[model samples]
Target: MARLPSGTAIELYESLDSTSLEAKRRAERGVAEPRWIVALAQTAGYGRRGRQWEQSIGDFAGTLLFAPEGASDNLGQLSFIVALALAQSLDEYLHEDQIRLKWPNDVMLNGAKCAGILLENLGQYLAIGIGVNLVNAPKGLAYPTTRLLDFIKDVPTPDSFCARLDHHFWALYRIWRQAGFGEIKERWLERAIGIGTEITVRLPNETLSGIFEGLDDSGALILRSDLGKRMITAGEVFFGPQP
Candidate 1:
């Protein structure tokens, strides 16, 4: 696409099981640099914790594959970077303050989830999958969902949005490569929702309640509980009292 930023190549498809899946296949074969896999619609998209990400025509869903040039431990930190990039893309259509990032990878708009991210470790390359609700919001989801057009009159097409998202992602990727996760952590915390606020995190085995202290340098969620402080590497977080 003409709008795609330089130094990047895109493999556009009308449909796919999942862009992330395609990216993973390519990563297995090997890639010289980061490349994007874009699909107009995904037949089997998924999110963090293996949740299904429903596909719609007007939404943006794409994945980028690239070798991990920095510390291997920082791979999880890409989720924060991807979240920030998605927030920037949303900023183009709505006011900045209206968008808040939920820990791990959900982008909240006006108190509802508008975008989600999924990161996969492919050994040689990292697969970054991002989904933005532009026109169609999945109904009957476990949590509240929203669309970009809900708050804005005009919304860009999936391809157009991916172009913008690519720009933001590349910018942040460069910064992280040159510097580190410190600046990314700072930016992510700025937009992070519910810091210092009490919340509940549901792990696979058990649920924990604690104050959302913030993220550690390595991108783990730091939760302060009655017992002590716990660094959560992965879990489902909900603000306010849980049902």
Candidate 2:
């Protein structure tokens, strides 16, 4: 509809170094139309903080190259939008309550991680990279992990999932553009995990222990720790004392 951004298209590849990398390449070459750069598998995929993200065949590996006209400053909010949209898309195949959104950019199914999102801000372009465990999940991760086939009787293929994800993403994108982040914060909190509970936040220099209060208007975390309530714009979170 007119609510969604124009000039957006999907470019599917058999394999790539990384969809996000491809988006950056396209941007470098001045290919400016918004697009979904997707790969069946990635050779050099990455997660938050440049950790290697291994992609197995049959999983969802894609990046959305979105050009936000007036959103260069408030780009952090897009992660919550992506999380909400991802949860909504996956909810179609399972009970809605089974899907939960983690702060920043992770999707939980049955209380285990099933998907993660990585955002890259490139001037006017934002490359939203996402990986979902469709058929199987990797082992030996610090936290628990899950997959779609674990719950769905018939899991959707990557291409099929892409269509659904695109549909839901645009829906939220419309709401965000029209109604603003108050509505987004409300919706995200409805499906959010660990609100009003104790959690750990891992920063680059140090870690902080706090109670997960909620998100502020700017999408930064509001943690209530011994140091009192403070806003944390960037950090990794844990639900319990680990380490």
- On lDDT, the candidate that comes out on top is 1
Worst 10 residues of 1 by lDDT: 1-10
Clashes of each: 0, 0
lDDT (Cα, tens digit) per residue for candidate 1, span 47-159? 87677889898788899888878878878999999999999988888889999999989999999999998888989788889888999989998789999888988889887
Can you list the residue pairs that collide in candidate 2? none
lDDT (CA) for every model shown? Answer: 0.89, 0.87
CA shift of 87, model 1, Å: 0.7
Over 4 Å off, model 1: 1-3
The weakest ten consecutive residues by lDDT in model 2 span 1-10
Return the top candidate by TM-score. Answer: 1
Clashes in predicted model 2:
0
